[model samples]
Target: MARVLIIGASKGIGLETVQRALAAGHTVRAFARTPVRLVGADTSRLEVVKGNALKTEDVEAALDRVDVVIQTLGIGLGDMLGPVQLFSKSTRVLLPAMEAKRVRRLIAVTGFGAGDSKSSISFLQYIPFRLVFGRAYDDKDIQEKLIKASSLDWTIARPGILTNGHRLGTYRVLTEPQDWHNGTISRADVADFLVQQITDRSHVRKTPVLVY
Candidate 1:
C-alpha cells in the first residue's frame, strides 16, 4: 500500500478519491482548507489536514512522508469568475512546496479547456465557456504550462463536462483530439482514473482528455 497525499479533499472528487484510496488499503493524508465530514472515512488510514494550497507554510506543513501527491486544488465559480490571479497564486504556492518536500510524483486535475483538448469541446458549450469562463481557463492554461515545464513526474488529467452521475467505470482516455463530441463524465470516475494513474505512470508528462 502506498502512502498518498491528496490536496483539496474537502468535498467532491477529492473526497471520493480519499475514500477510494482508503478502501484500497492505502494510507491517505487529505488536505483541505476547511474540516472534512466524510462518511465512513477510516480514521486509522485517513489523516485530515486543514490548510490552504495558496499558502506555502500550510502546504509544507501538510507534506508528510508520502509516495504520491494528487492535487485536486481548484476554485469554483465564485473565485474563478472573480479573478484569474487566484488560480495562479494557488498553483505557484503548491509547486514550490512539492519541490521543497522532494515529492516527485504529482497528479493534478484540470478541466477540458485547460489543455490542447480545448478545441475538442462542442461549440454550444464552448461559446459560454469562452466568454464567461475565459479567464479561469486561461489561468488553468498557465498553471498547466508550469506543471509541464517542471522537473517533477506529473500528469494532468483534463476531464470533460463533469456530472454527479454513478461511476460506470467505463470512459475513454485520449491524449490527442478525436472525432467524438459532447462528452460527459462523472466526477467519481475522474477521481478513480486519477488514483489509477498514481502508479500507472503511462501518461506521465502528458495531458489526457477523459470522456464517457
Candidate 2:
C-alpha cells in the first residue's frame, strides 16, 4: 500500500478520499485545518495533520514519506466571489515538494469546467457554470497549467458535478475533446478513480472528464 498524502482532507472530496484510501489498506496522511473524523478505522495508519495548505511550511511538512499526493482543495461560493487562491497557491507549494522528494505521482480533482474542457461544457450547464463555478475554475485553469509544465507523473481527474452517491466504479473516463460534455459523477467514484491513479499509468499526465 502507498503512503498517500491527501491535501484538504477535512471535508468534501478530500474527506471521502481519506476513507477510500484507508479501506484499501493505504496509509493516509490527511492535511487540513480541522481534524478528519474516521469511524471504526485503524488510526495507526492514519495521521490527521492540522494545517492549512495555503501555508508553505504546512504543505512542505506534509509531503514527508508520502507516495501519492491527491489534491482536493476547494472553496465555497462566498470565498469564490471574492478570491480563489487555494488551487494555484497550494499547487505551487506541492510541485517543488513532490519534485524534491522524488515523488512523481499526483492525482488532483479539478472538475469538468477546468482547463480546455471548458469548451465542452454543454449549453444546459453553461449558465450555472459561469454564474457559480467560474471563479474557482479560473484558478483551476492555472493549476492545470502548472501541473502540465511539471515533470511529475500526474493525472488530472476532471469529474462532472459531484454528488454523494455510492461508488459505482463504472464511471466513464472521457479523454477526447469530442467526448467531453456536461454530466454528473459521485464524489465516491471520483475518489475511487484518484486511488487507482496512484499506480495506474493509463491516464498519467492526462486530464479526463469523469462521468457516469
Candidate 3:
C-alpha cells in the first residue's frame, strides 16, 4: 500500500478520500488546520498533521516520507474573488514543499470552469460563472498552469459541480478538455477516484474531467 498524504483532509471530499484510502489498506497522513475533529478517524493507519497549507514550513514538514500528495484545498466564492493572492499563495507554498521532499505524484482538485474547459461549459452556466466566479476561475487557471509546468508527476482532476449524493461507484472520466455542462458527481465518487490514483496510476500526467 502507498503512503498517502492528503492535504485539507478535515472535511468534505478530502475527508472522504482519507476514509477510502484507509479502507483500501493504504497508510495515510492527513494534514489539516484542525486535528481534533479527526479524532474519530481510523488511527490504526492514519496520521493527522495539523498545519496551514499556506505555510511553507508546515507543508514541508508534512511531506516527509510521503509517497503521494493529494490536495483538495479550495477557496469559497468569497475568498476566491476577494484577493488574487488567495489561490497563488497557497499553491506556491505546497508545490515547492512537494518538490523538495521528492514527492512526485501530485493529484490536485480543480473545477470544470478553471482551465481549458472554459469553452466546454454551456452559455447558461458560463454566464453566471463569468459574472460571479470569474476572478476565482482566473486564479485557478493560473494554479493549474503552475502544476503543469512543475516537474512533479501531476494529474488535476476537474469535476463538474460537486454533490453530496451517494457513491454509485460509477462515473465518467474524460482526458480531453470538455465542459461538464452543469453536470454533478457525488463527492464520495471523487474521493474514490483520487484514492484509486495512488496505486492504479492509469491517469498519470493527465487531467481527467469527472462527472456522473
In candidate 3, what residue range of length 10 has the lowest lDDT sum? 34-43
What local distance difference test score does each model get? 0.82, 0.89, 0.84
The TM-score of predicted model 1 comes to 0.93
Could you give candidate 3's per-residue lDDT for residues 1-212 as a string of tens digits?
Answer: 89999988988889888888888899999898976254355779988899988888899999999899999876566765565555667788888888888999999998888888888888777788888878877888988988988998888898888899878888998876533444789988999999889877789888888887
Best by TM-score: 2
How many clashes in each structure?
0, 0, 0
Q: Could you estimate the TM-score for every candidate? A: 0.93, 0.96, 0.92
Query: After superposition, which runs of candidate 2 have C-alpha atoms over 4 Å from their true positions?
Result: none
Compose the digit string of candidate 2's lDDT tens values, residues 1-212.
Answer: 89999998988899888988888889999999987897676678899899888777887788888889999988877887877878998899889988988888999999898999998877887898888888899999999999999999899999998899999999999999899987888888998988888778899989999999
- Tell me model 3's lDDT, rounded to 2 decimals: 0.84
- After the best TM-score superposition of candidate 3, give how far the Cα of residue 17 lies from its true spot, in angstroms: 0.9
Q: Per TM-score, what order, best first?
A: 2, 1, 3
